[model samples]
Target: MARPIWSGILSFGLVSVPVSLYAATEDHTVHFRQIQRGTSDRVRNLRVNERTGKEVAFGDIVKGFETAEGEYVVVEPEELDQISPGRSKTIEISGFVDLDQVEPIFFDKTYYLGPKGKEYAKVYTLLQKALEQSNRAGIALFSMRGKEYLTAVRADRGILTAHTMHFADEVRDPHREIGNLPESGTTVSDRELTMAEQLIDMLAVDWNPDDYKDTFEEKVHELIAAKQAGQEFEAPSAAPRPSNVIDLMDVLSRSLESAGRPAGADADAGGGSEAGAEDEGAGKPRKRASAGRKKAPAEDLSELTKAELYRRASELDIPHRSTMTRDELQAALEQAAVPARHLRAAS
Candidate 1:
């Protein structure tokens, strides 16, 4: 169990629930230490006086506010503490609003709010259930660690969660920073729009967070393991950047073709046995007009490269195709082709 970062009473109207705030997430990114080249010594950072070139003691450090005249007003930590939010023990809920009403950009860090003691559990659970049923979040002011934050408290699963938010002034206008955005009056033809929608529908799948992996982190760990074993690490080749799309209709049409068969059909319509035998024979690869199971009607699978096979598998919505070997992809594609061909026949 982790220690709570904050403990306070969550108050709304006449109700008050004693709660403890625990960090809802953690950073798992790999970190590296700065070291001198050709030496094992770690680099050190020191706070020093610019004029005297002498390292300053930690006790000498003080908060300084620079004036317009280039003079700093030295302030003691105790003096700053006096003006701090004063660690208010209450998170006062101002009001409740629909969760969707809050823009995603305003949200910052999240913290889980648990009942501080068993005596408070019933009230805590009641608040959580109310928020969940209402599909709304409570907007509140929370003072912690010398600062006050505008926060949103909502029910996540069976518990209450709080997310710190940025004030309106902190968010900038996107138009000022971004250029070359599509014109407001720009429009697409109905046919093109329909085709794009079809492509999206064909490629759609259920959301599963577990399906995603941190490939960069995995590679970093692999590199570290190789270095520890006294082996040289060769970087993987970078993928080619896609060329800009000049023809919207062409792109949409190709995308639809690549999206293979629709869900739910016979999985053995195509000549599966023949495809497997041909794959075993290891014949010369061929390039198809479009990288999809059913799109390239006259294309031969035995002639396609591993990259082409993977692309076809992707269009067919094969799970975990990214980590599959060339042989594995080919086999998967063969199995996928059955339903794809069946759908084509029905169509």
Candidate 2:
């Protein structure tokens, strides 16, 4: 069994249940150490005194809170702990609210709550069942590790889960930060809206998180393995971002057709019968189906401008493209445009 990070009483109304909090998630990201380029010597960080220009011991460190008057109030760890919200070992539930009422942006970390002892299991189960039936979460204030937090306690699969949430004032208004948002009163044509819905229906699939994997992480591991084997390899080229669509209706029509669905189909009708299983690579714009017109022949590299050539190079996933000259880009594109079968036979 995993050890609990905190032990506290969950109090609401007249009932109090003793519970223990355990972290619900763990980090699995790959970590690297800083080192000199040519030498095996690892880089190390040190805490040094600015005036003395000497390294400081961990025990000698003190906390300082900067004041508005440009002065720091130097404080010891013990002094701060004395005034901390440490004495309150209770998660006091202030209100109950629908789970949907809470925005996901406000949530931070998640932890699992379990009954401290077998005796408290009944009350714990009672709260869990009540919250599950009501589709509501308990908003509470909890103090842990010398700090107080706003938290939401919700039931998940018969277990109590607590999520730390940002205070109302801590969340910034998006409207204040962003500019030129679409007007709320702006209207969409019924025809365009119906076609967009049909396109969406053609692309919709059941949510299965297991179907996705971090490809970048997988590539990093591959690179590490190749380096360990003393094999020379070039880094994969980055995919270019698609340009903004100038023709929304044309794009939507192509999307529906590519998904094997008829454009402007009734929203009430089921999706395309010929539609393949949705994958990560699905729904991308294909060159062959642009506006239901036949694909034009590849442009003459000698006739195209530098910017046009750069755009084509980007589309072809050329490496070191930002540094490539116009002629070099054209040559690279021509080399890449060679038939795959011919290249394979030559190899």
Candidate 3:
């Protein structure tokens, strides 16, 4: 079971429920330690003073704020508390709003909120059901780890799920970056749009998180097991894509036909399929090939040329391509190909 990180009362109006919070998500991406290339020595970060160019002892460090030219106000722990004595005990709900009205962009970290004891279960269930019936989320403020956070509490499967939120200023305006681009209207035709919609309909399904799996992680573990068993490594090949996608509409039409869905029906109308359910949360966006390998114009691998293979590999940003032999290149290319193959196959 996941451990609760904090325990406190969720207070609002005249009601208070003792509750505990546990992290709702975790990072699964592979991580590696920094090391020196030649000696493979693990790198260690050091604390050094910028002004004196000398290493500083943690005990000697003091927090300070610069207030004027060449001047700083050193602050002690007790003194710092006098400046801003933020509330650390309460998760105080101030208001409620429709859950849909809160955009996904505002969501930050998520936490699972559970009743601290049987005594609090009644109120917890009451709050959860109330929020569910109203289809609303509670806006609350809480302090943790010395920082204050605004959070939303909503009913999910009979429990109150709390999500920390980003301030309006934190979400960057997508328009600012894409503002100068030419209008997409000129590039998209009505036929292409219709086909695209059809393709989307073909792939549509209700959100069922249980279906997702981390195939890449699974493949990595499998490869590790094979390596441990001293199995011979087979050279990897790039899956071929059609060199010329005659027309985007054609592919969309084929995809829709393959899915057995009519173009006009709602994308998610069909009941449900369990085939790809395991891949729900673990699936990520598509990736490009390495810089050294040639890219296939289409997503399939058979349509690639030797030159395109080089380009695709390069686009994927694979390393050590310049001096690598064909066999080595193929092995490197496999790393990029496997995840994509799994996504397409699983989907």
lDDT of 1 by residue, 141-165 (tens): 8677657789999999899999999
Per-model root-mean-square deviation over C-alphas: 10.7, 15.3, 17.3
Predicted candidate 3 versus true structure: per-residue lDDT over 1-347, tens digit per residue: 77889878897789998889999889897666899999969998989998888999999888888999879998776554444453465688999999888899899988999998898888999999999999999998887765668899999888899999998888888878666866666575655665565445334444778979887777777777789899965545777687354576556655654544332221222321212212222343223233334432324444443334444454454543433433454565666676656666799
Q: Could you give the candidate ranking by lDDT, starting with the highest?
A: 1, 2, 3
lDDT of 3 at 301: 48
lDDT of 2 by residue, 1-347 (tens): 99999998998899989999999988767788999999999999999998788999999888888986658999876665576453358898989999988899999999999999999989999999999999999999877765778999999988999999999999989888779877889876664676686555434444778978877788788888889999976788988657455676566666655655433332222322212212213443323212333222344679875556655654454545444665776786776655543545699
- Residue 154 alpha-carbon offset, candidate 1, angstroms: 0.4
My TM-score estimates for the predictions, one after another, are: 0.71, 0.70, 0.63
Q: Between candidates 2 and 3, name the one with more favorable TM-score.
A: 2
Residue 78, model 1, lDDT: 62
Report the error of model 2 at residue 106, Å. Answer: 1.6
Alpha-carbon local distance difference test for all models: 0.73, 0.72, 0.67
Q: Give candidate 3 regions above 4 Å deviation.
A: 51-62, 66-71, 75-86, 179-187, 222-246, 257-347
- Which of the two candidates, 1 or 2, achieves a greater lDDT against the reference? 1
Question: Candidate 2 has which clashing residue pairs, if any?
Answer: none
Please give the lDDT score for candidate 2: 0.72
Relative to the true structure, candidate 3 has a C-alpha RMSD (angstroms) of 17.3
lDDT of 1 at 154: 97
lDDT of 1 at 187: 84
